[model samples]
Target: MIREFDRWAYDNRLRAWRAEWKLIVAFVMLAVVMMGGWREQWLVLIGMAYWIVARARVPFSVYGKAMLAASVFLGLSLLTLVVSVSVPFQITFIDSQLQPAAKLAVRSLAAWSCLFFLLITTPAPDLIAVLRRMRLPAALVELCFLMYRFIFLLEQAAAELMLALRARSGGTHWRHGGMLMYQLWMKTWQSYEAFSRSLAARGGVASAGHTHQREKAHVPLVDVAAGIIMALLLGWAWRKG
Candidate 1:
């Protein structure tokens, strides 16, 4: 389901004009604004959401799921900020600490939304291409590409394994779940080893010349100009703050 949205994002009309570097710069600028104050952070979050949904045409359901996952993690971490243990060893709610907790939550939400917008609008391969253009280490880019590919492969393998187990056992028990997890890890490692051997047989890692093709997509100058403007504004705001 997530991959479907990713594919859509990659093939979207915007991909032809949107530059990966511009998106990265915009995310950074929004992140700086998020750090300024909760009100500004919330506004940034809303604006990012709007751009993603309205301009990018990403489905709200897809965006909501991604936000929910990040929210869960942020909520868990904020609990530590809001709850305290004193010398008496009793956990107490700290009223004053709520302000910091709220600030952190809003900032985190804004940051996550910025990243999620990037992920949904840009494909991993395009991002790797941008890194190569930036002269990032070739080995590091290849490593990132392989890791991204393997993540999807592993997820598909796990889903198939779980479905087969459920079909045979009528549902998974705690013991069965543990055993299934063990099998999944073993299978993943086995696949990785086989893949490594195959790569070695092909004369190890291929050179960038043989692997990645240069991107031909036209990057919009307007977007780049807009990003520069936003960055300048963010810098001025940071200096004032």
Candidate 2:
């Protein structure tokens, strides 16, 4: 069932929508980065949150995990700052730093959440197709394609290595964990080496030739409207803030 839903989500129309929306989202994030203000950061957080929840339909369970982790780090940092407070430590500057850091955590979570959605909803083939359509250099597209393809191969290799290690059933605990760690590291290295050789042998052509592919994308009216709306919203956010 999950696989079916994922397949539907990666359909051409949805893939195009995700690609366009993500580009807009990235632009908003870039603006926030340049402005370097807490207000702009908050806007990025909101934009990312909307993209994840509304478009991606990420479960609250997953979001909760990220929120908890961020909260723990932020809380610890704040506590440390408060406990280390001194007369020489300017309170205003400390507070100012704290504001940006907190906003950064929120924005990072939001952006990651959107990326997670993309990974879940989009298939690798369709994503590469979209990038090709966007005029990304052929070399970059091929590299991106190979990286994604090999990640799963590497993960499976790691998993099998772990199972083999466990099957040994020798006295393996934290003290002997180093052996397993070394084995896993070597497996990953070798897997990547082999993957690289395969990629080279294939002439780094990860996908079918773009010969039959469209030379340009047909940007839908909905995409144009969304762009206008996002621009207005961002402008308002900047002025109001």
For all candidates in order, the CA lDDT equals 0.73, 0.60
Q: Which of the numbered candidates is closest to the native, going by highest TM-score? A: 1
Model 1 clash pairs are none
Which ten-residue region of model 1 has the weakest summed lDDT? 207-216
lDDT of 2 by residue, 1-241 (tens): 2333344455434354555555545655665645645565566566555544554555545555655766677677666543445688753445546665666566655555445556544566666877887899988987787676666666677667668777876536775577766877888888778867987998875464432222235556755676577567767777877
Clashing residue pairs, candidate 2?
none
Badly placed stretches (over 4 Å) of model 2 are 1-18, 33-36, 65-97, 110-121, 170-172, 193-233
Q: What lDDT is reached at residue 89 by model 1?
A: 85
Q: Please, what is the TM-score per model?
A: 0.81, 0.62
Candidate 1 residue spans exceeding 4 A from truth? 84-91, 208-241
Model 2 C-alpha RMSD to native = 6.3
- Which 10 residues in a row give candidate 2 its minimum summed lDDT? 208-217
Query: Residues 124-198, candidate 1, lDDT per residue (tens digit)?
Result: 777777787889998898888888888888889888888888889965578878877898999999999998898
**Candidate 1 residue 50 C-alpha distance from true site, Å:** 1.2
What is the Å distance of residue 206 in model 1 from its true position? 2.1
